[model samples]
Target: MNKTKNNFIYNIITKDLKKCKHKKIYTRFPPEPNGYLHIGHAKSILLNFNIAKKFNGICNLRLDDTNPSKENKKYVNSIKYDIKWLGFKFYYDIYYTSQYFYLLYKFSIKLIKNGLAYIDELNKHQISKYKGNFNNLGKNSPYRKRSINENLIFFKKMKNGFFNNGKISLRAKINMLSPNILMRDPILYRIKFNKHYKTKYIWCIYPMYDFAHCLSDYIEKITHSLCTLEFQDNKILYDWFLNNLKIFNKPKQYEFSRLNIEYNVISKRKLSILIKKKIITGWDDPRIVTLSGLRNRGYTSNSILNFCNSIGVTRQNSLIKISFLENFIRKELNIKSQRLIAVLNPIKIIIENFNKIKEKILIPNHPQNKNMGKRKYVFSKEIYIDNKDFKEKKTNGYRGLTIGNKVKLRYSYIIKAKKIKKDKNGNIIYILCKYYKNRKKNNVNGIIHWISKLYSIPAIFFLYYNLFKISNPENKKNFIKYINKKSLVINRGFIEKNIKNINNFSYQFERKGYFCLNKNFKNNNIFYFNRIVKLKNII
Candidate 1:
């Protein structure tokens, strides 16, 4: 069952179950194996999987790999990995559209024998010229009246690889002047001589999406065929093929608005373009919203699931602010992530009056959750604090160090700035300070986080921001032009020594945001972390 609050879709499923419309509800997430699954897909994944679990039904993960030109095993594997990472398990083995290719061809042959389909020799351009737009009416193809025998013979030849690509296609015999442009003699199958990733050279003709999708559902006995809003127009064609073939236990198609987040485009086509052009690193680039990208960026499965639930399902399309998602992640990590001090832009602070020896302080892993226990942090005479924590001269409401100002060290003692040192260029080299033994609870000056410079771990930090500067970059003529050049900022930093080999864990960098260790830097001696999100909006 979905542990989160219910949505409209769940209510519908409940009604169906009460009426005994289905003996067992079966759902499927059918994605084409052309690109990595993005965060938008996560919404659908959760909807299908959770609904199935809620009703004690089974959900199948099906790959719609009908188009071999852009499909490959790599994409198939990635799609599977992403779904699993989101904490879903398919009731059936992973299925593919290629599995029922021959069966679909038989169904097409039956449609031809029944005078419901014909082979047209029109090229793509000519076909488009005939299937008119919304404001126009379509003209019938010249080959529309071919006898069933002749059409069957031609389609068989097409399957035999006798025709060149785009030389011929099979179209359903439907209204040429239907109100819906999609139902106006839509093509059922097209000839493509490319080798398939799974079937190899056995097939030259492939069923179109409308032809394959509905029948695939019927063949699998899927009870609900959920799709994005773009497929709303195709529902007539989807039912057309099934009604024409008269398949039993026909699956019904339902459409819902897709997830759209501001400051990012989730279209697989645009994401692929970014990858091919090398504008971003890859499909798994942390800046990307791909499921793998989110996973690599340290977004937890529970947080993502909660986010999908929070948004709820709706028929109307709208853009959601990305900060809502960040807030969810922040809330989740605040309870789960350990509190650790990491200074991305460090300035050396020497405890001039200290005993010049290392001291150990026990700090709670999480300030709010004491049961998480504590870890030992080494406090030393030479320590590093964020450079931003110091000011040359005091401002009206400054929270950090200034001449003669006292501040509290987090989980430690109070510190008073005594003096500062600089080099030839007038840049402050270090700030000299003295530490007190007592912990101050009422100090007006803000508390700062720090790590011992001598015992801390050196690390490279990757700070991320929105991939595009514009909130709606997709609306632009060239979205790449709006790419945020400073999306990634690299910094050298220091972390506590106790964090060794715990790269899988995330940490709260004190006043800074949440951070997760980078997998690539594990082998190297130095640590590397990616900034998941800031503690709060700075502005």
Candidate 2:
């Protein structure tokens, strides 16, 4: 286990252990199965599971599948996959809030029989108006004075599907004038006719998140319910549900700042809109920050975990620069990824003075690690280099190929530019060069990567940029308007032939950025590679 830094939550857990507040600690990651997990979800997963591992406790994976209207089995499976992909194992069988529907319904009944709850006939808009804002106190509903027997009969009718969807809602008869708006008669149960993925139509009325969350925690015996800072206000209602029920061993709620990366949106609603409008391919689009998307873009689980740990746990919300997350993967791939030569903007280079048709050259897979071994490539009479690496008219300090200067081809002999050929439009189509035979170092302008025309493999490269043009797209009234049109740029390229057998590993494409085989790659004639990150951090 990696050593976790002692944060405020860690200190609290330690004190609880020392004081024997509980024999063991329990933590859970409860996610609504409405969409794919994002990087923000990763922070919670690591914190909960890591805390369990640190103190010899247990962490459970609980699916808050209370909202059947948007929940499904596919998202549940995805949530499980993401957690496991992040290298975490839940304590035992996965738990679902739907599993405790009976208990939760009975708990609501207990509240109603004790005269602590009542039924409200207010519509959605009316509920909002009565809830009031922070500036003004809310007014109690007309039904708040309903007799206990009347409330129970109406609640039973709601459970029996006698009430149409949104006709009537069972609410906790808390304070309507309370300062905390959430506590001002929050909805306990609502009628939803949508079929649940797990329970199907057996449940017409489902418990609200606030009602099911704390009760589910108590039933599961969760000791510490860790959540994001946005729930700091909801903590009051979270406790209210547990406290009113008078349940022993009630889990305490703790909040930490959620991971918010600039230029990204983790909100499920916004993400769904992006998909609906085809702003992105899907949740796994390489430009997205969703866990599946990051994994598809060649991010390793270790790099993500390290990034989460580096940020640590805190209560204050702040926007993290996207480079901070990119740096972790960049550093990890630097040591682990193999080096391969590729030319995205191919400009042909013909070595006129070369004696042999082709010769073999060996290049180390990694510069600093000899044990990573080397791969052989064909240095032929004709080769291709990136167009950006040459200049017809040399500027000051130009290090690439020019009329009078020599440049070194990586893992090959030095070559000097002698002449160039142009197309009908006066564009340089290719360059003619003469190669030196001696394996001796020469004063070359710069070293450049190339692939032999005879041995080069045709491939397509997908270069991804930030999906949003601005740092914070959510600030705009219409975030979609700020979507970067050039987020994905495709380039036809050539990679070394040897890369065919090494599809599983990420590679640094020599001077180009790090890349990995696209998850959708299948054709042998043309390979597809996705650019993971740049060779270095670029603003």
User: What C-alpha RMSD separates each model from the true structure?
Assistant: 2.6, 2.0
Candidate 2 Cα misplacement greater than 4 A, ranges: 1-5, 438-443, 474-477, 537-539
Point out the worst 10-residue segment of candidate 1 by lDDT.
1-10
Q: Score every model by TM-score.
A: 0.92, 0.95
Q: lDDT tens digits, residues 1-539, model 1?
A: 24344476787788888999999998999999999998889999998998899899988899998898889989999999989888898887998999999999999999999999999999999999998888899999999999999999999999998899999999999999998888888888998878899999999889998899999999889998888898998888888888788877788778888898888988888998898899888988999888889888989888888888788787889888989989889998888888888888889999987885888888888889999888888888999988888997889888987779888888887888888999999887889998888776576488888889867988889999999998887667688989999999999988888787354378998888899978766745788899888888651
- Candidate 2 lDDT over residue span 312-430, tens digit each: 88888889999999999999999888888889989999999887889987788889999989888899989999988899888998788898788888877899999999999998878
* C-alpha lDDT (0 to 100) for residue 474 of candidate 2: 63
Best by lDDT: 2
Query: Candidate 2: worst 10 consecutive residues by lDDT?
Result: 1-10
Error of 2 at 341 (Å): 0.5
Per-prediction backbone clash count: 0, 0
